[model samples]
Target: MSVDRVRTAAAARGLEIEIRESPRASSLEEAAALRGITPADIVKTLVVKGRGDQYLFALIPGDRSISWPKLRALLGVNRLRLPEPELALEATGYERGTITPLGSTRDWPVYADERMTGRRVSMGAGAHGWTLFVDADALIASYDATVADISDPIETIR
Candidate 1:
């Protein structure tokens, strides 16, 4: 049903996409390998909590982690945090690891990492055991996402 929602949303936006069945993987690298793409080609949708009842989606590459400081500056907010999995599910109608902007119950604003531009990227398909592929540029344009350097290499964060 979630996939159906995603499909409907994509159609409404005239955004072309491909959905594929995929096995669960233990890590980002494994997920990318399963999808036949590099880790950077896989985008992670993160639900960030802002002020009361406010949330936004952050699209970061699998090889990077959200840069909280950069994001805060971009959002012009001093505070932002990731809500618990349940809250995220309630916000986006998709479980963690399967969250995508498409078909979200609410149309939260999207912030995408600049590195994803002009490339094909794999992302969650609003359900487990599935992956959605789309043109990053089109996705950004479709959502009118704010594209910026909002992420840092995962190693730097670690």
Candidate 2:
């Protein structure tokens, strides 16, 4: 049902999206391998808990980590934490391995890092082994996501 909803939404917007199935990717490196794309192209979705137990989703580049202080400032909250896997699944209708910003049970306020602009990115598809690819700009526009600098610099190993 979640997958179908996402497909329907994409179709309504005339987005030519591709859903690919593969062995479950537990990390960005594995996801990149499964999708045949570089790590930079995979968009990682994180469920964060803000003040008053409110939850929001942040879409960030696979190669980066969320800057909690920056995100908290943007959200106007003092602190934030990653939700437990069970809570995350309950809120998004997707397990830890399959949470995407699209088609969540709630219309979550989405925050995308500035690095995602003008790129082709891949995200989870409501199930393990399935992934959805779309234009980063289109995704933000369709979801009414706010663009911000929410990532901490990650050094790449040579």
lDDT of each: 0.95, 0.84
Across 1-158, the per-residue lDDT of candidate 1 in tens digits comes to 89889989999999999999989999888988989999999999999999999999999998999999999999899999999999999999999989999999999999999999999999999999889999999999999999999999887434
Question: What's the CA RMSD for each of the models?
Answer: 1.3, 2.2
Decoy 1 TM-score against native: 0.97
lDDT of 1 at 5: 91
Residue 113 of model 1 has an lDDT of 99
Best by TM-score: 1
Checking candidate 2 for backbone clashes, the offending pairs are: none
Best by lDDT: 1
Writing each residue's lDDT as its tens digit, candidate 2 over 1-158 gives 66787787688766767887767657778769877889889888999887665888999898898999999899888889998898898878888867887778877789999999999998878877688999999988887899999998787679
After superposing candidate 2, which stretches have Cα over 4 Å from the reference?
Answer: 12-14, 25-27, 155-158
